[model samples]
Target chain A: MNSRLKFLLLNLFLLCSLSAMAQEKINIGEKQAISSAILNEKREIWIHLPKTYNDSSISPAKYPVIYLLDGEINFEYYTGMSDFLARPPYADMPECIVVGIKNTERTRDLTPTKSQKKSPVNPNVILFGDSGESENFVRFIQEELKPFISKNYRTQDYSILVGHSFGGLFAVNVLLTHPEYFNAYVANDPSLWWDNKVLISKTKSYLEKNKTFPAHKFLYVSQANNEEQNKNWNSEMTQAIEEFKGIVEKNGSLNYKHHFFESEVHGTVSYPGNYDALKFIFKGFRTDIKKLSKNPQLLEEEYKRFSEKAGSNFTPSETYLNVVLKFMKSNDFKESEDYFINLKNSLYPKIK
Target chain B: MNSRLKFLLLNLFLLCSLSAMAQEKINIGEKQAISSAILNEKREIWIHLPKTYNDSSISPAKYPVIYLLDGEINFEYYTGMSDFLARPPYADMPECIVVGIKNTERTRDLTPTKSQKKSPVNPNVILFGDSGESENFVRFIQEELKPFISKNYRTQDYSILVGHSFGGLFAVNVLLTHPEYFNAYVANDPSLWWDNKVLISKTKSYLEKNKTFPAHKFLYVSQANNEEQNKNWNSEMTQAIEEFKGIVEKNGSLNYKHHFFESEVHGTVSYPGNYDALKFIFKGFRTDIKKLSKNPQLLEEEYKRFSEKAGSNFTPSETYLNVVLKFMKSNDFKESEDYFINLKNSLYPKIK
Candidate 1:
């Protein structure tokens, strides 16, 4: 209660405060805006850099980036899913930078092939609006936005495009047209029925024309039970999605997957579907028990390739390596033992 | 450049800087350490508040809380996953708060009963150690920790307990012994084989004794294929999990789900399993397409109960109401229309 004791307590409080400040919150991500000439405006983007980014103590790393559409609302989903998928225990997907592109003009930017025909049923005023202009949006992303991100952040060339609904349509269109832009595309319940099913029809014809897709380009399409889940569901959208899935299934050259999520409805499918999409796209990246646990010695060679593919100086995280070590012996996994020993020496070399 | 131009540019830059300051980085959560008397140690805990936590202008809301084990690494996953699950387009769950409990002594706290026999095999010193003080740990949580959170934050009565591995064992132990603390229990790949399958045997006996549980409590158990995935995997752990699943299946009184995650292995099931666990526990919290899209009039009464269940003053979010309005005519959904009109007036009163 005295002034000296109070001063000591205050100093102790300040010290505790300073130490805990770093751990205050998980620094999930940052937001910034890009001045875009293509869109003739400034665009907002959310960036979640991986744990490996900007820490000088750890080895230098470049992470794959996901350029996600509907960034304002959906960015957190990608950030959450990506962070969970890439972290300890699962680590199924590589750690990556997630860039969420917030929408300024949803209909104008996301719509690829704008419809000229009027709605047969007098659409709601909010539902019907500006037609196309997605090309300029794509240009804004490719020319202005992507360049800006790469210049400012730690990123890799193995990029991905993620979108939902109309944004999903944008991702699909880009995969078919600008194939080189992203390595993988995830379209969750895409609006294939847009413009009187023009996208679906165009995609079918496009697949027929192009026999071979570039290698390693993966596309995952997720569909919900629209008709079954929603009574007022757009009939055309439902039917068109079925046809599009059928078309993609028939295309042998394309490395694509069309998944029917029967449990989810039109709106609620994004969360679980996108989570699955990430796992599907990045298959064979993690140390699966089925594949590698049988042959414990092969872990060394497999990890080398994993490191190469992840494009980062990858090592089995301490938690993962410990799990293996708990069950397996060093004599059985000679190569792994040596790798860890050398890594240990490099980290904490004995005094000369 | 002229002096006037330079001055204009500088002022513009200042304005932009000020505007962007608010959106600099997403404030994910905060951290604090609990001084525990039972454990005779200080334990770290992380807290993630919802979007509507402290904003005086929006609405006063109380959020459900999830107390997660192994808070150090998994905090990011919970923070990311919770933020996504409670946000737009897929707000299947309510905007709940998350509290992650970090460990000072893992084995000492997470195990239920001390093992009389040594580990089946000579366990890796780095991977194994002393255990069997979960009772004291649980006491610390129920006594010291819970009170601190309730005192510090706006929390609801509904709460969830989540854990993985040995942490999962602790979750099961607490659920069986102290069922009154949490509304939901999620054990992701619980270490049922601990202390020579003592926890599993105890659970079977516990189930036999308790014929009826408190109505509102829910438990979700996830299992992974250890033996099938790993050829050299421990048979004891695998068989123990099967028996545990069998026990849960035969018991009819307990409202529980025992899911076998065949696709995932021992280490990787936590990510997807925890995600599924959240969905399972909060069953029927979200608006369904089939239920509402037809009668849209039913949205009001349904949301009232949902709000009560979620323990928040929950109304239809703006985006959700707007989506409903897009397809249905104003006359079609009178109840929903009236609700929105009053909500709109309350939100923006100067319409005249």
Candidate 2:
């Protein structure tokens, strides 16, 4: 090739390569060690901030943080879900930060009690097997991790604790013992049957002594068919919560929701339950889809509230309406259709 | 202080240091390229075979394969879902080999047409822009990739094609032009609006001239509010299909299903849609949940069918029942509850 042609081709190649590299791999970010404490040695952490997080033009923005356990498995699931949920109209949920805590010793960190027999993998190893360290794990979160996160990120006071299996057990333990730690709690098919329902029994005793759990929301969910197995332990867990709900009703301090996911199981119920939990806990603040349809002004008012509450300068757009409608329909919330139409009318009143 | 003690302590320190070094970081696998003659390039591919896949005792079993596009992003998503789905009753969706085609040039490979406007990003200056390289892409799968995959792995003829967005568009293109490429095609929020509805228009033309497509299943889905912005165009696309549906009904040679995701978006709709599509498409082949509840024999019959079809001697366990029930409830297919129960009963008649 000619010298000029070769030079042009080289420049073009460099530009294309740069552009391809710049397209941004959809990575949330790298995993990093958040704490150096000896107990925190095996624990790694990952955080996902939204794409709009760095935009200074979008000011005064703060996000709710979701602290998830079993980060190695669920970090990506929540990250992907949060990314899509924060996109448009059902923009009811803000683009929050997701903090995933990787487990070092799942049994030690997640379980409240040191049950020697429960752990079948190792019978001889004392410290490595059935060694309870949940109290220390919670301390790590409350003292070290939370403080570091609050200092580093633009965050709202609102926080959520999510867990599955043993993680679910940990979430419940935290919610019961340190209720002030999180605004919302989701226990996805928790092992309430742990240690012959030690947690459940302790929960019953805790409710007797404690009059209230503040203004926090607790969602206890179980999959449908697990009722027939293990002597219907899931139903019993729900019943225990129902008893706790009675105590909360008498005290009028805690708002508790019990959902029996008759279709879900221990492992696969997290996805739908998590989505529903977010919707349920925020139901009080949800935009009135019905009222909005009758009046375009209502939709605008709701958007204003969303922006104000989320502490972001988010405007309701066409894309937003599409997203809201989609989420509503998928969750079988069809009653909100007219509200979505009203939202569309209000947002793009000039289009027609 | 003794010389012998000092030597032993030094050796212990060295061993501890080596162990720490090994445990410090995770071993992320190295990237590799897969050669394909049809594309005439070594495409980057990601392969994840399950832990059970390597077991020689389970040899001579041909596993089903799932081919995913936008592998870099959606590969993990499907991997997680498949991991969860294959566990229990939902185990109807067998454990399969996952092949993720990592994108080197997404726009070039994914887009069906080579438009001048969108072609500027092409580095090769091959004028593949708007040139319709989908045929070549399909040929690469048929001629090169498939042969390589079949040669390397014990793969059954049953294969599934999963794609999202532009990848989804490509999936639909392959399904229409080359129906025999895969047994099932999952097009999640395909960009039917691409090139001003070029694919949909082409589909209309193809259907008009065609006598019938092969015996295959096609799943066309759109996120809930996706229709709100370009209602006219979206409706036009739907109308085109409806027109084709009329034609298909008269001839009765093809099987197609259209799902309107009123609650999902282009980005977030894939999870629910993919789950539902798999459930719906494979509904009849598996034991009817309701039937299984009433008759233990039905569950065994369904298992036999599943085993025969999959070419694997897999049986549904209690864990599988829990997972399937969880999935059905999460998707709000409560009506299928009876069928699931029946299937469970058939699988484990003694339990019920």
Candidate 3:
């Protein structure tokens, strides 16, 4: 072949290869850093907005927020999970913004009481020496992090705090120390045994003072299978959780759920625990689409009931209304379709 | 102010604002499209590599791949879940490459038979008009898609097929027809009643012919709470699943598990179902780090047993080995630490 023709063929091959290799990224969220005065350090957070949050066709919507501890470990699955659960038509819960807090001092920030112990594996070494500054950490979350999020994102009043292990201890500490901070709390196999079960005593004192958990509050605690851990180093972990479960169940005032995961170890419990917590926290959020197709008015009634229980007002999302409209339109339910269109317009007025 | 000074101030303000708003995306995967000869159409696929896939410190690793149906709906969460479950120290399964296939013609590609029925919502309207070309679809996957993946990625021989609803039906159909295609199959709330339970008959005939499933193959089926569905138009779905479950259990030859998710509905079952399916498929894959500290040889023994059952030669991943070495070194298990170092060096030899 001539030199010019050879060069032309090479260029063509390169062009085809480049086109074939062109790829699009699947981005779930973004990383943002904030300087926290309370903690006296810069904290990085990962924020994930729900799928409909940026849809141009729909009116902008506010979402309930979840403050996830152990951001680096849990953020990806947690965001994916919340989105899956919040899909329209069969949404188990409302769309949510997940702010995953990355750790600067994991032991110090998550432990409730300053304590030190010999390492389980090496008795000569000390562990958790710099532990127990959760008060300052919670302060940072409340005074700095929450404001940063609210100022930046379209967030609803309703929020949830979720954590595992020491992070779970931080969640319970926050609920005990500042009950009004979050609408719901999830602690997955928490280190209730920390400082000899300090949180259990705090829970008792709070119940004695308040007589019942502040109205409309919810707490979901998941206990991992301790049969193995009991044989290992964390014997007190399961016992403490069981003791706490009895006290809360006896009080029967807090909207409380305690699930014992028989098959999961402490390391694995948070995954399934988070799923169950969402289901429990938003027990009445799922509205039947088939029923809605028949009785259009039932949508408002269900929302009203759910709002009353959630202690927060929540209207149907514009995306959900659109889904309902499509379902009704495809089914030839003209009246129901019209009903949902009106509902959508009333809730999310088009700016133009 | 002087004009030059004013311009400098404006430029400084712009730089500050831009830096403050700078964001990094959390990307899980990438999208790629390929033209399929068997199906005679272009198909898009989302590919998610494990977190360690591109780590410069580690050698390139070949990984088991999961072919997830309904890429648009399930890719995000499925990728996140796999990564979470594959974390070191308590890794439940091996890190895997996830290839999610996006659908073009849903009914036509997923259904096993060309059949049409009246729309459940609108009796006058027909549904699934151009139904049934799953044979062609499977051929596309086997002949075109699999080769495309194999050529471009570092892939282990083992693979899994996962689906829900119509996609789930497609997975089961493939298992019966092309049992050797994948190592495992997961079907969440599968539409077994599709085309009048055609797959159930196919399963019966396959069992009759083979007398037993191929060795080392696994299947997991999850049934959702069909109470609401039973009251609706999908009354037959639950019965059909139950019938399939009975027939499979009676055969007692396939490595199988059937779970009933009492809380999950059809639309929401896949989230939890996928988690359970992974645990079931890789039941003995988790090695105890605590135990390994004392008995370093136990790691190889466990992997051997697991591999024997899996019919795939499994070994400890470099990441898992690193985690183990760290655990041992920190805990002062000097001998065990040395043992793991040698194991890692032998398994992942550095190119010097």
Which one is best on TM-score? Answer: 3
Tell me the tens digit of each residue's lDDT in model 1 across B1-352: 5565555556555554644564487767777877899889988888888766776554455677899998876777676677677664446777778899988888889998775444323343233456788999999989999999999888777788999888888888998889888888888888887777997878777866876655567788888866443333346667677787777767665668878877776676777788888888766667653345455546667778765554444566544555555434443555555555565455435434
Candidate 2: residue A74 lDDT (0-100): 73
lDDT tens readout by residue for model 2, B27-131: 221134677766777897666554346555322345678887877656655655564555444353666777878876676677788654322323333343544
Error of 3 at B189 (Å): 1.5
- lDDT tens readout by residue for model 2, A11-37: 555655644543332345456677548
Best-first order by TM-score: 3, 1, 2
User: What TM-score does chain A of model 3 get?
Assistant: 0.93
Q: lDDT winner among the candidates? A: 3
Q: Please give the distance, in angstroms, between residue B164's alpha carbon in candidate 3 and its true position after superposition.
A: 0.7
lDDT string, candidate 3, A1-352, tens digits:
5565556556555644543443377889999999998888999999999999899988888999999999999999999999999998889999999999999889999998999887766689888999989889999999899999999999999999999999888888888889899999999999998987899999999888987788889999999986566564568898888898899899998899999998988998999999999999999998988788889999999999999999999998888888889889888888999898888889988876
Over B215-256, each residue of candidate 3 has an lDDT whose tens digit, in order, gives 999999999986566464467788888899999999998889
**Model 3 segments beyond 4 Å from truth?**
A1-23, B1-23, B231-233
Candidate that beats the other on DockQ, 1 or 2, i.e. the better one:
1
TM-score of chain A of 2: 0.71
lDDT of 2 at A55: 63
Q: How should the candidates be ordered by lDDT, best one leading? A: 3, 1, 2
Cα displacement (Å) at residue A90, model 1: 4.6
Which CAPRI quality tier does the interface of model 1 achieve?
acceptable
